[model samples]
Target: MKTKSLLLAALFAALTAIGGFIKIPIPYVPFTLQIAAVYLAGCLLGPKLGMLSQLVYVLVGLAGAPVFAEGGGPSYVLQPTFGYLIGFAAGAYVNGWLMQIFQFRKAATVFLANLSALFAVYLFGCSWLYIAMKWIVEKPLTIGQTLWFGFLLPVPGDLLLCAVCSILVARMLPRIHSVIRKQEVVS
Candidate 1:
């Protein structure tokens, strides 16, 4: 069970890194479908294991794996994008927790929760970016600028990706999980 779960975590992390690699940098933040991966990890793996997946991602990157945006290692962690990286972890956990609270993994609930979790990602990323840009860059980043650069433009792209991920997961989760459960019972 543990091994299977760990394997899942690593697989998801690698997928996320792949998603991160394909991006177009906007003014406030880069646009990537990584958040879709984050949300999918949580919904599929649940909260505790979802977080472990992200931890594994961070550890892999710290170990000099190019599994993060702008590459990995201690330097990348210190980079401005680092906060957004952390936000990915937080967003995964938040998505799972919120789903558990709502107890609504139905199509409708899952859709809304996925959307909500997407916000959680951007919220953490933008807030962290604001602080980092101000302190690290020594400049005032206005709220208007932040919203425009961070939120408005990327919402559509993120929305589409999240929708695709959520729908795919929603369709596959039941069958896949059931197969695993059946194997466990047989064993």
Candidate 2:
């Protein structure tokens, strides 16, 4: 891997970890700016690197970095919200892939890409929440309650963050790509 790419991935992972600190605690899942950071990673780094960045974040947290909204460590995987953490990586990958297909220049395309990524996160999160809550946590919840508690409650804020991230991605992509191209030529 190029040094610059690796550095960018590390920087994004760090940003995500930092973002976890800015949290709004709720019942099942806490709202956090980490999703915005995840979006930024995808929009800035592309799919492969973006996913790598999220993986780095997860590994660091698993190593007891205390980088999650709550605490960290392998035990975190048991948490109902852990699915969201896993979703972050998938969401970033989907965001980057959609950006490649749709192109980020158009505002509508950027918005759609971000929205799609958000849905990917929700899908993984809600599914994991349902399974974990029912089997592991032994707190069985109906589908409606699961959707309400796990997904709907925080969606509005996520949508707002998506808008903000889409705008930022649209604005920054050209410059970021230009830099990468220049680096490639130099190399």
Candidate 3:
């Protein structure tokens, strides 16, 4: 189980990194493929495994891998964007948790799950940004500004990714479950 978990985590991290390459830059930040990856990771992997996948991505990037947005290093991980990276873990974890706990196989259920995950991501990312700005930049940001830059700007793209990924994952669940089951059998 540990080996399989690690392997899947590595795979998701790699996928997240690759997805990060597809960027749509906004004023405050860029929209990336990570949302889709996060949604898919969570819906398919379940809460624990999905969160593990995101954690792996973060650890890999922090370890000096150039897999982060706009290239990566230790410095980038400390930047404001790092908050969003961390949020991805929350997004995936909550997304998977919702999917498993609720019947999210249908369209409406998927929508809510994705929305919940997005909300989780936004809350975490914005909170971290607010504190980081206060600590590092020495400028306190307003709720409006944070919402504009951190939450509002990213929502459209993230939602689009969520919709697409949710639909796709709904279909792919059987195959994913099969693989996980087979792994359990083999192990």
Candidate 4:
């Protein structure tokens, strides 16, 4: 069970790196499936493993793996978008926690879990963006501007992704859980 969990976590981390490469560029931030991969990791692997997966992703990128959307290095931490990268782990953790709490059984619960995960990501991303812009970039932004640039602009797309993630989680969790259970029995 431990080995399986670690293997799956590594796989999800790799998938996240791959997801970053497929992006739609815009001014504020690039739209990528990376968050979706994070969502799937949590919903599929549960909180601990999912979070572990994201951590691996971050660690690798920070170590200069070039796995992130732009590029990767220790200095990447100074970038405004680094907040979203960190948020991915937090969001996955939240997603996994909600999935476990709701037992990943109901459509509404699945939707709520994904939505909450998205909120977690947004919260972290926005807060970090605000701080980084002020301290790192030396360009302070008002709360209204932060919301407009960091939160509001991306919301509709994020919400749509959350909805799609919810549906996918609903459809996949049962089978995935069943396999995990069977594997646990074998172990």
List TM-scores for all candidates, in order: 0.89, 0.94, 0.88, 0.92
lDDT of 2 at 89: 94
**Candidate of highest TM-score:** 2
- Model 4 TM-score on a 0 to 1 scale: 0.92
Off by over 4 Å in 2: 181-187
Model 3 TM-score, all chains together: 0.88
Give the C-alpha miss distance for residue 76 in model 1, angstroms: 2.3
lDDT per residue, candidate 2, 61-127, as tens digits?
Answer: 9999899998999999988889888888999999889887767776567888788778988999999
lDDT value for model 4? 0.86
Give the candidate order by descending lDDT.
2, 4, 3, 1
Judge candidate 2 at residue 31 and give its lDDT: 89
Give the distance in Å from residue 46's predicted Cα in candidate 4 to where it truly belongs: 0.9
| Tens-digit lDDT track of model 1 for 62-85 | 889988867777666555556667
Q: Candidate 3, residue 73: CA error in Å? A: 2.9
lDDT of 3 by residue, 78-152 (tens): 466678888889988998999998857876677778788888888888887777777776676787888888888
Global lDDT scores for all candidate models: 0.77, 0.88, 0.82, 0.86
Question: Candidate 4: RMSD over Cα atoms?
Answer: 1.7
